[model samples]
Target: MDNSAQAPLQTAEDPLFIGGVGLKSRLFLGTGKLGREELIPEIVAAAGVQVITVALRRVDLSDKSGNVLSHIPVHVQLLPNTSGARTAEEAVRIARLARACGTGNWIKIEVINDSVNLLPDGYGTAKATEILAKEGFVVLPYINPDLYVARDLVNAGAAAVMPLGAPIGSNRGLRTKEMIRILIEEIDLPIIVDAGLGVPSHACEAMEMGAAACLINTAIATASDPVHMAEAFGLAVAAGRAALLAGPGRSLVAGASASSPETGKLTAFLEANAASG
Candidate 1:
């Protein structure tokens, strides 16, 4: 057996720090669009995801019957999102309600005034982040990846900033790559690339670009084989992170750099071609 083929897994490295919480998995999974609640546990395990996002409005009634919360593994951290909130005030209310569920105080502030595209309102998100952070909630605000908005979020005491790669559930991978890259360059907080990531490769691309994490939902849950897709995403994220740590090579605009040694290079092909000509 080739010893080189048996390299160790990359997840053994230091845990990702977010809002003073150390998380082992950088891939944050959203528990939405999952047809059945029973599948969440297996999906989470398959994805090796430490943080799972859930919407407040989706929770089953408090009658202790068919509650989605019961399905999630207790070990995984819950990050409840303000999906139905359209303003900062509304977002704050929903966040408070989510906290009342006895889930830890991790909140993903998503204040969307635009219903058609479902784009997060940067100002409203910052506002909610401020209110939540002061209230002792670990705030992770979803935004449009604008540098100014990110600055505002940091000032508002955001633990991390979740920037959209594209519109929510569009399955358009990295449409806002440049903006996300700008956030990564400028912001001090962890930049989590969330939403619109179509496939495993998209998550891999975001991770390779130095994103602190990738939050995905529609892509995995809607797949024909959700469990396998989850596993694929987990592996892709790990490989991309490893590649980032390995320090990828520099790019050239219009030139090729030869890999093989120039000395005693294969002249046989050239000579044969010349003879044939």
Candidate 2:
């Protein structure tokens, strides 16, 4: 029953906060390309996801059994995305329709005009985000890992900036890692790495690099065992987050560093023994 709209902005225990809601889980699961609609609840529970993204086109209000909304628990925050919209105008229209369906105000702006690459149009996304944000919707726009576009979204009143790790559903695993790192460093808002994550390691890498969150779909849904995959992703996300919080040691550029002391009594004893032999 706890939705983003009603949830508090911050809590003592919860660290990941988006759209005025504190989420314990950093992974956001997508409903599209799922193998079975019936596995939705189990997938969600297995992943321990607090937010699930559903395409507006996939929701059927009339067919109760087929409706994606029916399978989702009321407690989870619904992130209705404009997946099929090819233009800003079309995206805006879909967002309004999604709201009318009582799915909540969280909208993921996906304006992809490039049919070949399926990359989002940055200009159109910014326009739609500005329009929707003013309308009191929590706008999370998906874009190629571009610094300027991310800045534009921030100025346009976006809740968080979602930069794709690679092409949508490619499962390529952080091809744009450097650019995404720049966004995470410079952007004041939460930089959620979305799209093209292939495995649990990909999600883990994103979290390790200080990404506020990650949204994955194809990798989990198309796996041999979806429930187990979801669980793996959940554990991976948590482990990466904990590692980040624990402050991993700096990586050396050339020379290797030993875990134990290099110039200690043990090293001296070993050297003496070797010399005597």
Candidate 3:
């Protein structure tokens, strides 16, 4: 094996590095087809995601009063992603272009070979990561949470792996939990749960299970109350992870639900409250 191939695996102690930028928050947000740009900042603030995903080719320089970029605050770093490209070559070209446009070193490599399903070809993902990492770009590969694929990505110099919970717009919760679990269990690198997270709980579950963070967009943007939902999700992710760190309740063998009140039940508590009123 080449000496370069002997690069050690990543560890949790080390933060996710995207070129020169280092993100503190694990939750990632994407700027996709969702609308109401006014609500975007509010939602981003509510969710407390340190890294925000932006597409390279989709950038409409024609409208450049810095309209889109201006809306985003300076504090939250931008993660330029290759969302529209079909092949690794196209994705690489777009990534480089986006890096130049945004002047950001951190790039999320998204090589979606399957346009219809929008699946990340493991081969394409690996290729992109290798090429980008070689170019000294802080590359984060958005891939399916396959254990082998994820390991390969990390080995290929990926700063992080972003595995989808479900399809991009499906709003499904952890459809690939088992795969995510495998990645979390094995890789020392940041395993970001990206896409298909519908609610805050989904994010929390991923984090609690040892995911470095999660990415969300459609679910938050489409909520009846987008801003409030973002806040709620932030709290939920924190709460779930807190529970994990604090240690969850242990299970015991039982014939029935052990959660039943020993002293009083819900009916009794309601009756007491009613009497007091």
Candidate 4:
């Protein structure tokens, strides 16, 4: 009657509950940089992503071609982001439009004012989260890894807090590792590390640091081979999560610790040999 043996195993379908919805996959892929829109579904399938993101904007009558929506499979949940919005009201408007288009109620509030860095405006994001959450939309706000902003977003009803490891699309790997670590420790909600993850190793590092999930775009989209790259990231995320669950060892500040028994010391062996000789 071992309880451990009887316990249910954590499978791939193990749900990550966010905004009251259970998501199967921790990797949330963004539909932005695939060479062709037709490649999206295939990439997502290769990545095994259960949640995907999309942007909202006015329909382009000039192109008169297939839209990005048609490429996305119906099984995945859509997380519409307010990427172009500069204010809370603008973000809310976009969210409303996205919902109206039947894209579901999940929204990623990305209110950016810094054009140079493409950094999210924490205040504007929190403001939008408050409004959208009140309107029954599950809000996931992207912000700098600032503890105060994270706290504010949590208070504003954010389903999860998305903190940047580096500037968006920089391909930098966890530049704000310390700050993100603090957020992971202090924030009650899921800490989804979005932006600045250049490689699979970077995503793995975030997961190893106990990040609940990661939102990667350029790293996968701009790779030499995006399809295979997506697959690598998927494996990296899972490996990192497993490493986190395995509980990493503590770091040594300066000194080295012996891994094996000191009793079988080489010095002792030498002394014995000399005495025998």
Q: Which predicted model would earn the best lDDT?
A: 2
**For this target, which candidate reaches the highest TM-score against the unseen true structure?**
4
| lDDT, residue 80, model 4 | 93
Model 1 lDDT-worst window of ten: 1-10
Model 3: per-residue lDDT, tens digit, 1-277?
1112211211233344555555445667776765666666776666665677777545466775435576676666778888887788988998889778755777888888676778788889889889989998889899988889888898899988899999888888999999898988898787888889998888888878888777888887788887787777767666665666787786775734656555455457787689677
Clashes of each: 0, 1, 0, 0
- Candidate 3 segments exceeding 4 Å error: 1-22, 58-66, 253-277
Superposed Cα RMSD, model 4: 8.2
- What is the lDDT of every predicted structure here? 0.86, 0.87, 0.76, 0.85
| Residue lDDT tens for model 1, 1-277 | 1112212222646568887766767788887988777888787767777788988765445664676788887777899999999999999999999999898999999999887999999998999999999999999999998999999999999999999998999999999999999899899999999999999899999999999999989998898988778788888888888899999997874434465455345566787689667
Pairs clashing within candidate 1: none
**Model 4 lDDT on a 0 to 1 scale:** 0.85
User: Would you estimate the TM-scores of all the predictions?
Assistant: 0.86, 0.85, 0.80, 0.87
Ranking of all candidate structures by their TM-score, best first = 4, 1, 2, 3
Model 2 scores a TM of: 0.85
